[model samples]
Target chain A: MFAFYTIYKGYFRTALIVQFQYRVAMLIWLLGGIIEPLMYLVVWRTVSEQQGGSVGGFDTNDFVVYFIAVMLVSHATFTWIMWEYIYRIRMGLFSVMLLKPIHPIHSDIADNIGYKFLTLTVMAPVTLLLAWFFDASWRPAPWTLAAFVPVLILAFLMRFYWEWSLAMVAFWTMRIDAMNQAYIVVGLFFSGRLAPLSLFPEIVQRAADILPFRWMLSFPVELLLGRITPRELLIGIGAQLFWLLAGYLFMQLIYRAGIKRYAAFGA
Target chain B: MYYFRLFATYVRVGILGELEYRANFWINIIQSALDLCVALGGIAVVFSHTDTLGGWRQEELLALIGVYFLIGGLIRTLIRPSMIQFMEDVRQGTLDFKLTKPADSQVLVSIQRIEIWRLVDVLISLPVLGIAFLRLGASLGPIESAVFAVTLLSGALIIYSFWLMLSTCAFWFVKVENIQVIFMSMWPAGRWPVNIYPTWLRAVLTFLVPVAFATTVPASAVSGRITGATLIGTVALAAAMLLVSRWFWRVGIRFYSGASA
Candidate 1:
């Protein structure tokens, strides 16, 4: 326990120092994160208004609230480590990382959390700007708000573990571009980045419900926007827990196999 | 004339280099096919819900997709790879070799690297465009066809200039590798008609990112939806951005070469 805490604190401190050095770049990235969801919010709101107040259930204000929630959930859970892993392997940084006493994932988790803490300052104001721009309104029940905390946490863990496992594929393949593209394309469809799962066809919605991607993003956003029923929320949480376990097990297997490959290849 | 020969040489080298790796040809084909499917899938989903997206008919939007792929191919083939190499050179301080060359720096930098395999995007896009044109079911007059060609050229120039300007920022900002991420994020918005976006985003896509000219304007010309004013404006914007990018490239090279000292 003490060793884990020491490694965690050490990684957190290092990430903070590195982020401080490139604060402006981090801010630019934060600006980009702000723009995408805001753009979608406005487009959906326009569509809803044109359709006489709502489309498929979500009204203009519902879109505004849902998208803002999505912005926060996506920011909280998203990982760019797949691209970073490709770079680290290509540039020989992975070897140095492997030599460290601590596991690399501990440092990545610490870095992700640390980076989000720094960027949330920017995201908060941007969220407020979006809310103000769209005149978003939401009134979540106390139970729903209480349920949101654990759902968001599970969503973040599931996303981080799944993407980290995806990144491990870089250890075995020099050409991971095709894999990356495929991952992103599927992620766009499944994770509710393109559109809400509810707005998709019944078949797509069912697939999203069964997959882990919707839990990573759309579930939490829907919960926060008061768009989910209590029964649905319970099912969502149950699904998230199952996927989290699956992702954890998959990560363990992949990491062990990837490390063996890396050791054999001497990289 | 000299630049044409330089481009020919670059293309030949690029093709030969790519040919050495046989697997890369298949990979490129798969990647391009996946890209086409994604675009078509998005269109299918949208049309399934509604007949028109932000006033664009299905056939017209198909033409827009063709222009998107065509210009996308042009960028990947020539502009993106070269700029990426130029940025890498800046990072490694190997740009000095290019600075010593006798040819114009901007031209050389723009054509220095090519992934000849990206011609697949062009090859795939032509058939898509032909099918879209046939679906529109109108016999395009020579005048309209000529206008579409000119607009396509202008749009290409605009995109080239905009990308060159962004890549030139590498001389000043070494960490601008994520600039491509910003561009890629914005490119998806282009997959839809720019008019679908709100006013501010429309303005940004037009005046700021200039993606509207790259895909939409040429597409509008082909669909006979373009106005005289919009056509002239696109041409003027292309010319102005070209000059501005050239000037910026000169300034960037000066800073890189220590001429500011």
Candidate 2:
């Protein structure tokens, strides 16, 4: 454990400096993240107003707060490992990664955390600015705020593990774009990125409850919005814990098999 | 006519090169199909909540999405790939080879690379527009068709010029690829009508990026929602932008010193 901690520290420091050098690229990517949710916020807000200030139990202010929460939570939990892995494998960069004593995922996790740390400096202020601009009004209870920390962390882990596992598909075939797009389209609807889960049709709502995507993103946002009950919170956290473990185990299985195939190629 | 033949040759070469990879055609079809699903799904979800969004009906919005993909296909197929190649050339000094050629460097750079598979987006958009038109029961008169054709052409030229100006900035800045990302990041906003955005964002989409002209204005023209003033403004902006971008490209070329130099 102590050795792992030291390794993480070194990786984090390197990642921080490397990411800082490409801060402009990072900020430009963040612009996409910010704009998508903001567009949804505006769209739903328009829908709510046109329907006389409320649609499906969400007022315009509720839509504003909901989507703002979405922007933050989605940003927090998102991972680019799948795409990065494709690039690495295609460029033969993974050969070097495999030579390292440590697992490659550790560096990716460290890099992700380092990037989020640097960008949060910008994201925090932008969040506040958007809140004020959109007239966001959501007052979570103290308990809700306290629970959000652990839930958010679990969401991040669940997303990272699942995406990292999905990245292993690159080992089998380099043509992962279609698979990635399908994943995104599914997540867009199921994770409540397109709209609130509550606003979805009954069948979609059921599917979301069964899928892990909701637990990764929309659950944390919903919890923070004070829209979730204590019972629902307990159930949701249980689902998150389940998916987190599942994703981790699946990642381990895929990595071992993928590494075997990768090594066979003599790369 | 000489330039046209050169363009055709570049396109023919691109097509022949891509034809070597036959599986990529299927992959492109799948990607385009998924993209269409996402666009149509977003409209479906939004219309589920209300009858209209920002005064756009479901079918009209579908038409807008169709145009979004159509323009997006054109960019990916020609403008984006060529400009990205240009940036890479500038960075690696490979641009020296193109500059040494007797042809106009701008024309050569602009039509140099094509991802023919990306044209799948253009083909897929037709069915979407057809469905939208069928649902709207809209008949296009000669004038309406003429206006749309003009606006669409103007929109494409405006976008091509905008991309040229953007890519030309790499002459001074070595790592301006991120600038391309900024354009792409803003591109999706055009998937919807710009008027729904707050005033400031609307302005940015209009003037700074001009994605509105590329998407919403053309859609509006076809839908019979465009005003005369907006039509004239789009054409004027396209003409002005083309001239400015041409001048900017010349200036950028003057500033570019090869990496070996």
Using TM-score as the measure, the top candidate is 2
User: What lDDT would candidate 1 get against the real structure?
Assistant: 0.83
DockQ values per model: 0.35, 0.82
- Runs in model 1 lying further than 4 Å from the true structure: A31-39, A264-267, B90-93, B169-181, B251-261
For model 2 the interface RMSD, in Å, equals 1.0
> What digit string (tens of lDDT, one per residue) describes model 1 on residues B101-141?
99988888999999988889999899989988898877466
- Specify the highest-DockQ model's number: 2
Residue B220, candidate 2: Cα error in Å is 0.6
How much lDDT does each candidate structure score? 0.83, 0.91
State the displacement of the C-alpha of residue B73, model 2, in Å, after optimal TM-score superposition. Answer: 0.3
Please give, for residues B27-62, the per-residue lDDT of candidate 2 as tens digits.
899988988887888888889989999999998899
Tell me which residue pairs clash in candidate 1.
none
Query: Is model 1 an incorrect, acceptable, medium or high docking prediction?
Result: acceptable
TM-scores, all candidates, are: 0.91, 0.97
